[model samples]
Target: MRSLLFGVIAITILGLTSCQESAKKTPEFYKDTVTFDLLSDMKSLLDENADKITIDDVNNLNGAIRYYSPIKDSLIGKTIGELIEGQKQRTLSTNINLTQATAFSTLFTQSLKFNISEFQKIEQENGQPLNVPTYQFQNISGKSIVKLSGVVDYYNGEQLIKRFTIEIDKEIPADKTLNQPYPYNHDAKNQRDVFVRDNFDKLRKVWIPTMIEFADGKIYKRNPDKKGENQLDKDAK
Candidate 1:
């Protein structure tokens, strides 16, 4: 009887030890993963919710232009023949190319929040319509990201739309310069860089709606005033 009792106790101790070892434990370093749930009110633009919001309440850049649909579109009596060669071509090149009226956009975001910080105002002007002062913060997750509330323009050449983009105010880890995409030809490389830079700039045109709120009080929305290409320009020197 005494031997049996000792054997049972030993088995119980071993089982408990095995149970502890079997449970998976997260690495200590994982404690530093940022966990702030703070995010922009994205549904404002998605939900079929009626258009109670004004032109400024939300960005209108998405689906602004259907890309690469038309080839050549000309006005009446202004066919390519008279516009190009002196001869009056017989049949119309129905290929009249007209710019589409919509485009698409996607924004990657990083959420950020903190225990305390100073109040800041929102403003938009010139080509870059964004200004949010950096505020100090302490987070429980130990990972800190900058809070930047901004908007970008969605455009394809002549077509333009406004997309509201919110970010943690840090360069994306995987972001690469547009000019770095694989290529060998010299002239092609130059043209490719131009295309990439234009695309990048088109990603920066943001429109400030009538009113928005932040750490401060009510704020006014503003869009960049510009002519020329009628688009934003972004390229690193």
Candidate 2:
């Protein structure tokens, strides 16, 4: 009876030891990996709720680590929950101001209109006729436009042929139109016309307002598109 009791106690001790060892073992995926490779693997393992990993997902993860150096030590051996908690803590530590820039931009764009009113022909010093384009900006926002800057994309049908910068520092009052000559010379205008004529079937242009400043000292900037082509905001028409 004494021998049987001793044998049972030994077996119990051995079983407990085996369980502890199993708990101490590192997961196979985490061993001998660091940096982006480790982050990529971690993201794949952690995001089980996702249907599948996407290129954007990978790119965003990579971007997160790109600016921070020596992140390998910080990320290794951390679980998904731990990583998320750390991110939240970091965000709380940082100071940032969220403003109503987008809302203001939407309002301004909805109230403004742009068009090429006409082309005026002028005789140059060399007795050559030069065609200059005129632009019209109509403000119906019930507020004056204090300052504006953006780009105009000239397209032939659906194809973009030329781009020009537009800047206005003076005040354009509510319910009024501001007519001005194209900021560029006749040579530039002729160049654009020729380029469009040779490359495409139809000529059209879109005004893409990038930044605007109002009288109250608030500013708005349009968000850039990732594909390098900016579209006219639907609200602006």
Candidate 3:
């Protein structure tokens, strides 16, 4: 009887540990993967409308496209005029203008720009030196951003050194400057300084906004796979 009780207790503990490990491996959200067929359709529409559409128009359409089965099927072979009309009709019926939603997202993203001002060495309460990076975000889009999340890739000359995801849930008012420190702190000032100095040239392109949320509850998300050459650039030609 004593041996059986001990065995059951050990099994229960191992089961709980296994469950916790499995939970940790699960992601908070899955990637919104775009299909190759959808990409081909988007390219087809752009090629068909090359002479008729502006870059902004293309951007709006790119933002408006959805990967869901029904919507994706409907947009497979649409002309420029057909695309615009469809967007309008869908907006009227669903009360959601994907194009407009995308436009707002683009506006908010383009409005905010960031630059690392300097690296400071501060003494902590424990009398240890901490190296913190001072950075500034300038919002010029005349609209406030409620939340923003993205990946910041730090490069040394041409080689990638560090990549980290940054999230700001606080309200950032339009035409205002927000000064904040990088979330990471280093113990060695010399190492931090060397990394910063090497990555200065690529600083401007470091911030790639993956998602943006406005005060009105509209959210915009960028496809992770399409990093440097986004749909706009691919379709513009």
Give the candidate number with the greatest TM-score. 2
* True-structure RMSD, every candidate: 28.3, 12.7, 25.4
Instruction: Tell me each candidate's TM-score.
Output: 0.16, 0.47, 0.44
lDDT of each: 0.29, 0.61, 0.60
Q: Which lDDT tens digits does candidate 1 get at residues 1-237?
A: 999999999999999998766543322321222112211322432254333323322232121111111423222233212222222121122112111101101011112222112212333353332223232222222232222334334456645532434333332122221111111122323544334344543432333222122222222222323211112122211
The most accurate candidate by lDDT is 2
Q: Residue 172 lDDT in model 3?
A: 83
- Residue 144 lDDT in candidate 2: 76
lDDT of 2 at 202: 49
- Which lDDT tens digits does candidate 3 get at residues 2-105? 99999999999999999878655522211213345645666764676465556655654554564223554654455444444455565464544445446544
* Candidate 2 stretches greater than 4 Å from native: 1-105, 127-129, 186-193, 196-201, 223-237
Between candidates 2 and 3, the one scoring higher on lDDT is: 2
Q: For residue 136, what is the lDDT in candidate 1?
A: 28
RMSD of 2: 12.7
Estimate the overall C-alpha local distance difference test score of candidate 2. 0.61
- Candidate 3's C-alpha runs over 4 A off are 1-109, 125-128, 187-205, 228-237
**lDDT tens digits, residue span 145-206, model 2:** 78887777877777777777888898888888999786333453476655644443346878
